[model samples]
Target: MTAAILLQLVLNGLAMGIIYSLPALGISLIWNASGLFNFAQGDLLTLGGYVMLSLFGKAGLPYIPSFIMTVAVMGIIGYALSQAYFYPMLEHRVNPQIILIGTVAFSVFIRNLVLVIWGTTPQTYKNPFGSSVLQIGELYLMPHVIWIVAIVAVLLITLQYFLRGTMVGTAMRAVAQRPTASYLMGIRNDRMIALTFMLSTAIAAVSGVLISPIIPLTPSMGGIIAVKAMAAVLIGGLGSFSGALLGGVAVGIAETLFAAFVSSTYRDIFIFGVLVLFLLFRPGGIFRASVSEKV
Candidate 1:
């Protein structure tokens, strides 16, 4: 294969991997905070995209404003879901496995609900970027892809700071680690939970809005992403943020390169095959979690 072809595939993979990383990171964050896996994150991403569709596509709002509104709106939805459903279950001491199942059910519910509202037709919106391409030497890159990389990079850096440096972030971590003690210290654990959900959903919104321009929006589109994100989280090492990101990029690149150099027909099979291999040998993933988990 030519070096140019290889470079192109890798760059494309990087863009797609960044998309997967958003949800994977969110999964890791929510898992750490609640010890409950949220299988509905992909649907949340779908909702975010649809919300952006309303604000930007139908209403003709500017991209920046639409994005901000989508994030705010989805953040509210996440907080509400936590306050109404997740927190209630926690208060009643619901089984963690049951809560996880609930997320899967919720995932299905969101897709159906979206169908009820948006119908069966796939949708697309005019991107303000307008099919622009950036050229550097012999390489050509899509503007949207570049935007994805830059935006996700900034988001990752900001998130690293938020979780490590900010008081709210610290309190949330404390609550996750020791809820009773944090309560004694006057940290409102409920608020922390709500905040975690808000952040996670907002991240989903970011992915949704970013991805909507690149792909047609379909009710079940999130299902494809949901599976990919789950795979990434498992392959990355559960509860490890960096691992989630790394795993996502790794999977994206592998999928793309395999499709390009090998065969496109069995690309997904190759992906799952890689997943099985990882499970067999490196279940903890490349950046192993401090606490390893078995597949």
Candidate 2:
């Protein structure tokens, strides 16, 4: 590929990785805080897009107002899903396998629900960027890309600060590290877990809003992303935020390069191939979590 083409591909891959990482972070959060494997996380992304479309396209609301409304609605849905599906199962001490199945059922329910409500017709959101492209030397970058990257960067920084500086963030981290100990320390582990669900869901919604203008919105649009994010979580390490970020960018870059150099059809094959290799070998991922010390 030419230099500009190569640059564009790399940038696009990075943007895609950022998109994947948003939901992957949510997946990692839910997994770490509550040990709940949220199979419907991707559907939440789809839900956000449709919600935005409803408010923006149908309701004729302004962009900022529609976006704010989308976030509020998505947050409630995320928390409700956690409470209904995850909280009950965890409270009753259900089998982990059963919980997994419950999440899968939830996933199916959300997808089918979208199909019923949105009628399986592909939808697109109003483009906030309005055909804007950034000209950088020979490489032209889509404004959406710049926005995605900037938003992800700000999110990462904000999250880092929150986890390090805030009481609730530290409590959530402690819960992830040791739920029993956090409980002993008087932290409401259950509440923190629920909050994690809300936060993660909002993050997923942000991702959906950012990406909807770039692709056709459909109920099943998130299917591929869900799979990719799972790979990202696995490749990044199950519980590490930095690892998730790195793994997501890596996956995005790899997919783009493969599609450009090889066959677009085989790109997914290569993506999963990498995941299998990672699982077989460095299953702990690129950034292995430090072993908890017990005195």
lDDT of each: 0.88, 0.85
Task: State residue 122's C-alpha deviation in candidate 1, in Å.
Answer: 1.3
Clashes of 1: 0
Query: How much is 245 displaced in model 2, in angstroms?
Result: 1.0
Question: What lDDT tens digits, residue by residue, belong to model 2 across residues 1-295?
Answer: 5889998999999999998898999988887787777888888888888888899888899988898889889988878777776777787888888888887887788889989999888888667867778899999988888888997899889988987899999999999888889999999877788889988998888888888766888899889988998898889987788888888899999999999898999998898999999888887788874323210
- Quote each prediction's TM-score: 0.95, 0.94
Q: Model 2: runs farther than 4 Å from truth? A: 289-295
lDDT of 2 at 99: 86
What are the RMSDs of all candidates, in order? 1.8, 2.6
lDDT score, candidate 2, position 82: 71
Best by TM-score: 1
